[model samples]
Target chain A: MELADEAIRLADLPAADRRTIMILGHEASGIPSEALDLLDRAVEIPMVGTGHSLNVAVAGSLVLYKLAGLL
Target chain B: MELADEAIRLADLPAADRRTIMILGHEASGIPSEALDLLDRAVEIPMVGTGHSLNVAVAGSLVLYKLAGLL
Candidate 1:
């Protein structure tokens, strides 16, 4: 169990720990339950605007920037 | 001067100061020089990856979150 003991920190992990960070974009319904078994946590973005959706590439970029501590 | 003395702190301004924040989306060529005169500054997102662009809404949302201290 190479990564068995390693808990997925979700997107909440510190920027410095991103070397092994893996990102998977999924449908609005969410990452399939089966796939969730392979991961440790479901990262969620908190939104305050009236808009309820975010574009994938933009969201991806935002997460990357946040992970890199650039935002 | 209603707001003539204010400098458009650019995207670098603190999130809480967004009441007067006006964001302008434009082409890669950038905001026209004529429009630049009306704006106090040009905001920029620093990127470290090979990807050279970010989608407008995602980028906009990021700034809004940053301004609101959500990120």
Candidate 2:
């Protein structure tokens, strides 16, 4: 899934055992509309900082680690 | 701690309650020797991919989330 505000928290995803594919888009604009349409769900990483969001790479890795149950 | 071959796993760190400060440096060279001298330990995020290492932002964010115990 892609990152979005209304999406579920990455931590709240059902289980780590299920294979998953994560789509990370541009840091500023996010995934293209066409690509987003192909995905079934989106996930968000809750942040308390003033920054707009975490870097794309950082966001992607965090999701991967969480989905892998490594973090 | 910085990323290193012999460092402990970020997940293996003692507890999430401790306050921690993470220093992330250039993706290619890593934390400079001067800064490395001041750090007491290092932690690693094991990878199964062929990539040499993760992007600096990704690595840093992962560490931060782990330290925060939010992952």
Best by DockQ: 2
Q: Which runs in model 1 stand beyond 4 Å of their true positions?
A: A1-13, A25-27, B1-13, B25-27, B37-41
Q: TM-score (chain A) of candidate 2?
A: 0.74
The backbone clash count of each candidate, in order, is 1, 0
lDDT for position B35 in model 1: 65
- For all candidates, state DockQ relative to the true structure: 0.35, 0.52
Candidate 1: tens digits of C-alpha lDDT, residues A3-58? 22333322354565536454554535555556667764445565566866556665
Q: What TM-score would chain A of each candidate receive against the reference chain A?
A: 0.62, 0.74
lDDT of 2 by residue, A1-71 (tens): 45565579866765467667788877678888888878777777777669877766677777777777666
Best by TM-score: 2
